[model samples]
Target: MTDFSGLQQLTSLIRNIEAQMEGAKLMILTHEHREEIARHMVEGLVGPSREHKVRIETSSGEYMNQLAILEIGGNKYTFSKDHQGMFISEINYYTCRITPNSHGILVYHQDYPGVIHDVSRVLAENKINISSMNVSREQKGKSALLVSLTDEEIPQSLLSRLQQLPQVQQVLSLQ
Candidate 1:
C-alpha cells in the first residue's frame, strides 16, 4: 500500500508537468505567428514599394513573394527581396534596376551631337551635381534625358538655357 501511494503521487506530479509544458508550447507557437505578421507589415510600407502578388507553380505549396522596390529613379534601384510579406532583412541578396525615376527633371528634344555634353556642362557650370542620369532615344529623332540633380531648386536660367539649345524642344522639372 505504501509503494502504491508513492507511485500515485509521482503520477500526479508528472501529469501536472505535462500540462504545463503543453501550455508553454502553445504560447511559443502563438508568439512565433505574431512575429511573422509584424515582420510582413513593415516590409509592405517601407520605401518605393510596388506589390505584385504571384505564386509558385510547384507541388510543395502555394506562396507569394512581394517585390520590394527601392527606386533610385530612372530604371535604377536595389532589388530588396521577394518575400511573402514586407519582411525587410538584407537576407535578399538579389538586385535589379527597372522603370527609373524620371520625375526630377526631364529634357526632351531631337537627338543631336553635343546635346548631352552641353547639358552636363550647363549643370557643371551651375555647380549642380547630377545625382542620377538616364537617356533614351527611339527610332526617328525623338530623344529624352532624365536627370536627378543634387539641387531640387532648379534655377529658371538653367531651364531656359536648355530650351535655347537648337535641337531641344522641352525642358520640364517633374518633381
Candidate 2:
C-alpha cells in the first residue's frame, strides 16, 4: 500500500505539536480535488458535523506542476509529486523535502556547530543507528530541520533527552 497523503502527514504533525484544530480553519489551493481533499481532511480531524469550520478554496489558475498548497491556522505547507515521489516540500516558511513514509526523527533546531554531533552522540549512546540524514536550513545560524532515517526505532526517553539538548527546539519521532 502507498503511504498516507501529505494532508495526513500535516494532520499528524499538527496533532504531534498539539495544535488546536477544533475551531481552526484550513484553506487548500490546488489544481484538482480541492473540495474532496479538504472535506476528507477536515472531517477526519473534527468529524463531519464540524467540517464547516474549515474553509476550502481553490486557486483560479493551476499550479505550474503537480502541487497543492495547504494553509491552516497561520502556517502554510506545500505538497508536490515528482519522479522522486511525493514530498512535503515546504513547512511554514522553512523549505524541506520530506517524504511521508520517512522513518526516524525530525529535529527542528538552531543551525549551529555541534548540534548534529550532539544528536548523533545521543543516538549512538542509545544504540540507535542512522541509515541516512538530510539537513535543511533557511540561512546560516538560523532555524534548521534535520531528517534522520534510523536503522531502528528511537525510544521515547531518548526523544525527550534529545529535546532537552541545547539549541534543540523540537524533536519528533516518526515510523
Candidate 3:
C-alpha cells in the first residue's frame, strides 16, 4: 500500500492557496497509481458543496526519481524521494529541497544584494529565529525564491511587514 500521510498536508496547502481563486484545477502526474493518488487528492481538496470549482487530472510520465508532479494554477511543485528522505523538491519553477511539516515563510522577490538582509532585518526585529534557509533563482538579477524555516510561528503582521519590503513581490507563510 502507498503511504498517503503526506498527501493530506499537500492537499491542505493547495486548498489554502486556491481558496480565493474560482474554478481551480489540480493536475497530478505520477509514474504509477495515478487513479489512487487522484482520488486521495480529490478527497482532500473538495467538499460536497464545492466540488464543481475544482478539477483534477492524472497522467503517467517519467519525472525525476518517479515522484508525483502536482500543478496548481500555473505553478508546479514536486514531491521527491531520495536517500535522505522525501522532500518538496520544486516550487513554482524554482528548485528547492523542503522537508514535510516545515514551518516557515516563502518569499518571492527580485534577486539582488541586500534583499536577504532586509528580510532578515524584519525577522530579527520580530524575534523570529530562522532555523534554516534556502534560496534559488533561475538567473542573476531575476525573480528568486527564498524559503526560511523558522523556530516559531510567523505572525500575519510579520508577513505583512515582509510584504511591504521593496524587494519582495509576494510572501506566503507555511505551517
Candidate 4:
C-alpha cells in the first residue's frame, strides 16, 4: 500500500502556514485509489484549519497520481514526491519559496516593463536590500508572482505604496 503519512503531514503544515496569513480556504485534488483513507486523514489533519472541509477529487493525468494539490486563498499549490521518495514539489508557476530569516514579500501582478524598477525603487528608497528574488509567470507580458526576500522587514507604509502601483494586484508580507 502507498503511504500517505507524509502527504498528511505536509497538508497540515501548509494549512498552518496559510492560516497565519489571514486564514486559508482549502481544496485537495488527488488520485482515487484510497479515497476514504485520504479524506479521513486530511479531514483530521485540517480540522483546526480556517477551512475544514477538504474537497478531494481524482486527477486524470498519469503523472498526477502522487500529487496533492491544495487551493488556498484562490491560489493552487501542488505538492508531490520526487523520485527519491520524498515529497518535495509544489506547483512551480504559483509557488515560490522565500527563505527563512529573511523578510519576504509576495507580489501578484501583471508582467510589464518598469514594474520591477518601480518596486525596487520603493525598497531602495526605504533602505531595504533585496537578498533574493524568485519570479514565475505563465507567459511573457502576463500575470506573474514575485517573491522577494529582503534584508530587513518591510514596513506598512512601503507595502501600501507597492499595492498602489498600477501593475500590482496584491502584496503580502511574510516572515
In order, what is each prediction's RMSD in angstroms?
22.2, 3.5, 2.7, 5.9
Instruction: Kindly give the stretch of ten consecutive residues in candidate 4 with the minimal lDDT sum.
Output: 20-29
- Candidate 3 residue lDDT tens string, 117-139: 99989999989998888899989
State every prediction's TM-score relative to the real structure: 0.40, 0.74, 0.80, 0.58
Candidates arranged by lDDT, highest first: 3, 2, 4, 1
Model 1 has how many clashing residue pairs?
6
As for TM-score, the candidate ahead, 1 or 4, is 4
Q: For candidate 4, lDDT tens digit of each residue in 37-143?
A: 45534653465354554555555546653455556655556655544442424434565543223475878889998888888888998999999877787789888
Runs in model 2 lying further than 4 Å from the true structure: 1-6, 43-52, 151-153
Query: Tens digit of lDDT per residue, candidate 2, span 1-175?
Result: 3233555554555444436554455555554666666655565455557425655656664565435565665667676666666666776666666665455788999999999999999999888888887788889999898877787778889999999999999997764
Each prediction's Cα lDDT score? 0.39, 0.69, 0.73, 0.63
The runs of at least 3 residues in candidate 1 whose Cα sits more than 4 Å from the true structure, single-residue gaps closed, are 1-103
Prediction 4 global C-alpha lDDT: 0.63
Please report the candidate that would top TM-score against the real structure.
Answer: 3
* Residue pairs clashing, model 1: 43-86, 73-100, 73-101, 74-100, 74-101, 75-100
| Best of the candidates, lDDT | 3
Colliding residue pairs in candidate 4: none
Please give the lDDT score for candidate 3.
Answer: 0.73
Q: List the residue pairs that clash in candidate 2.
A: none
lDDT by residue for model 1 (37-116), tens: 32332222221253422111112212233222222112211221232212212111222111212223456667777777
Better of 2 and 3 by lDDT: 3
